[model samples]
Target: MASEAAPGSIGGAGTALPRHVAIIMDGNGRWAKKRFLPRFAGHKAGVEAVRAVTRAARAIGIEAMTLYAFSSENWRRPEEEVSDLMGLLRIFIRSDIDELVQENVRLRVIGDYRRFAPDLVKLVDDAIARTAANSGPILVIALNYGAQAEIAAAARSLAAKVVAGEMAVEAIDDAAIERELDTHDLPPLDLLIRTSGEVRLSNFLLWQAAYAELLFVDTLWPDFDAAALHQAVTTFAQRQRRYGGL
Candidate 1:
């Protein structure tokens, strides 16, 4: 694991960057409402922001970036809106797969896919398979994910092991539970950013973000750009991460 240096530690040329960064993309509906356009329009524009940010993260040397794309709670949205969002996801995958491949960016989806439509699940699987060989930074998309549910599932899995005598109940530790989570293979989360002025985690990466520095920006998801990402990263580089130590 690549641990971050203490605050104010300068690297060879510039400030050391976070190894892993996660984002909560928010305010698409509000952006569209303010512009007197349908909410779906904002979602379409948000896709462009995702592309821009992905390129920016890769350029800035971030090892991994996780995006809170669709939440498990999003199923309560209006039928038409949900349909539109799903359509946008498909379009994004199809249109951007080539670029991602060329850039050596690996696409990984971390969420429960059993509830997704078969075709949508297939598209996700295909995207992951296609990018499996990429050596560059990873782009993790959280679709239909809920942090509480994920934690409960991990706990249940461990409980089953104890019941079957496969593991001792007292042996359960932070590291043991982390291995069962969806982000097990990714780098430790270093920074978490929420756009549109939201200051809450909103059920995103609850465990992984335990020690991550949080940044809240007022920019809507549709309006977010590389410059915004750069600013957030620059701010992150200046913060001290004590992790309970002085």
Candidate 2:
């Protein structure tokens, strides 16, 4: 467990209590490489980090937390690595679904997760259904997701609506496009953090993070734990979000 991060109080650290936080978990392969271990070893280790971070975020009163589990480009990796990742996903859901249900965390996913094998898809769907009614924190996993594709798809949807005379083209503003986005149900992204010292978005959340606070740290995904997460949130608390205004 992490030391409590006091995001509700804003006196000392300013008023930026991030309601939603997203993280780009990176450096798993590198972490394994440095240890002379298989890349799967680091990825497997990263799962523990995910669990710890989820628990810590829930404890901190975060409304929603999104993790970049797999991007569309990830499929281009070695087939063995991809298979290992899928196996890990199955293991995580099977082993942790009960715990998530007990904790009242609602499980949700963005992207074409069905692209996975039918058995794995069923497992994921069952897990989602199991936690659909939970009233606690929402956990969003981006599997096979890409920001550019998401935006382009949303635009296509709106364009289709225009063609069908459902909504006029002039009405397609920010909110309109947002409704078609994968994160429409989740709270507005308040903080976007990338581990492993990566500063770029790397096609994570293009539209939702227009004004979100961005933080990059050098911690590897496999080593990221509750304390690192709490520290990141505390640092986020100290920043003042101008949102394009002084």
Candidate that scores best on lDDT: 2
Off by over 4 Å in 1: 1-13
Give per-residue CA lDDT, model 1, range 99-214, as digits (tens). 99999999998889658889999999999999999998899999999999999999999999999999998999999999999999999999999999978999999999899999
Alpha-carbon TM-score of each model against the true structure: 0.94, 0.95
RMSD list, candidates in order:
3.9, 1.8
Candidate 2 residues lying further than 4 Å off, grouped into runs, are 4-7, 10-15
lDDT tens readout by residue for model 2, 81-179:
999999999999999999999999999999889999999999999999999999988999999999999999999999999999999989999999999
Model 2 alpha-carbon miss at residue 144, Å: 0.2
- Model 2 has an lDDT value of 0.90
